[model samples]
Target: NTDVTDQRSAEEQSRYLMGELNHRTKNLLAVVQAIARNTARSTMPEAFLDTFAARLGGLAASNDLLVAQDWSSVHLEDLVMGQLRTIGADEDVRVVVGGAPFLVCPQHAQVIGMALHELATNSLKHGALAHPEGRLRIVWTGASSANWKLEWDESLPSALVPPERKGFGHVVMVDMVERALDGVVKLEFRSSGVLWSLNVRGPGVGR
Candidate 1:
């Protein structure tokens, strides 16, 4: 009777564990499906879906990094490097990272990751990365007043002028900077290249 009771208890535990796993799996799938549906219905369907999927994947990757760091804040440089890896960036691509490594909260890291991804994708499709002769220069520096400045300069001399209508990428970049990060973005359409400057106060600065 003891042996039979032990077997029944073990089976019950296994069944409960399986049920929990199934429930969590179903919830995850539902989330993904919702993301896909909303993305597909966006203004720029293709770019929206692509970026949405990529951002979701980036969040997963960032989560892994967070786990590795025991859920503590991550260094800015480490977060940037980890995100670049998700998009297959390397030394040969003229990518440069600068500034002292500051610890970034998880929420800030995710937003920055998405913003960076948008910048990269824009360069790849219509900016610097579109031409072999073009170059992309990214620089970041800190101000004494606790503000951070980031610049994205793309050298595409032969590229066409900026489109009259702003697309999804443009909207995402603008929203991430102004709304999400509470930053200011300045866009310049110089003859030599396109310059984008973002000035953001560090987290908790305004609030």
Candidate 2:
């Protein structure tokens, strides 16, 4: 009788552990599903779900990269390039990146990654990357106040201003910059191109 009771207790413990794991897994899936739903609902129904999924996946990839580095900051240049590749943009896609290596906190890195992804997706859909003759220039510099400024300028020949209706991508970009990073975003519509400026502050340079 004693042996049977011990075996039952062990089995119960194993079952309890498995149940707890399953519950946690379900909760995680629920969170991901909520994200997908929110993304879809925020944009027009015609917006591509695949694109939304891809952006979320990009965030996951960035998270993994940061994890590999033990949650330390990442180089701005490398992080930008990695996010670009996540969305299937080739290095030869008229995309120019220039900046001295600078470190950004993990939280900053994630926000920057999302912002970059949003901008790249917009370019691919309607801004610069839509046309073969178009070009994108990304530049970054550090300010004396320990702030950082990154700019995205695109020269799309004959390109028109973005539509009056702001999409989910735009909303996400603005919110991430303002709320997440406490940064400012300036968007300009020019006859020759579109220019975006992002100003952010973090730990001092070389920290």
Candidate 3:
């Protein structure tokens, strides 16, 4: 009778672990699906492939950070830098990031990381980072215990005009990322450059 009880307990533990694995697998698949759909906007096959690959790399980096922290929370600075590094933003001397220390919940890190990836890619391709003299400044502000705001401001060359068409980058920032964080996003295109602002509420704040 003792042996049977021990065997049953082991089996139950195995079943529970398997169930948890399945759940996490399903969630991962869902996230990948969303990324695929969002990254399918490029008309050229090569462009699509490149963009998709970079986005996936960003997601992987975010996951790595979350895992390192036991999936509880990650520092906002680490999350930003990880995404930037994955997208090669570290190579640019003109890009700047400054903010008070804060924590990002695991639930929002992936989305926010992806959003930063998209922004950096856009800047490298068409925004400030595309030109030799253009510059980018990213700053965040808020009390540690309340909501926070982050801004991505770019300064371009004198003669550029705003894009007439909305691209995947725009959608990711204004729609997908904003919705995911349950926050608000504002993007403005001025002659100086593009300025993007994100306001995330306290509920989205990590412990």
Top-scoring candidate (TM-score): 3
Question: What are the models' TM-scores?
Answer: 0.69, 0.76, 0.85
Which has the better lDDT: candidate 2, or candidate 3?
A: 3
Runs off by more than 4 Å, candidate 2: 1-34, 44-48, 143-145, 201-207
lDDT of each: 0.67, 0.75, 0.82
lDDT of 3 by residue, 8-110 (tens): 9999999998897688679878988877886685436667777778888988999999889877889888988887788577756988888988888887887
Q: How good is model 2 by TM-score?
A: 0.76
**lDDT value for model 3:** 0.82
> Which residues of candidate 1, in runs, are more than 4 Å off?
1-38, 43-52, 189-191, 202-207
Ten residues in sequence with the least summed lDDT for candidate 1? 198-207
Cα RMSD (angstroms) for every candidate in the order listed: 6.5, 6.5, 2.7
How many steric clashes does model 3 contain? 0
lDDT of 2 by residue, 89-185 (tens): 7475598999877777776677678778888877887778888889899999874456788899989889567668776667666775677677788
Predicted structure 1: lDDT = 0.67
- Between prediction 1 and prediction 3, the one with superior TM-score is 3
Worst 10 residues of 3 by lDDT: 38-47
**Considering every candidate listed, which one attains the maximal lDDT?**
3
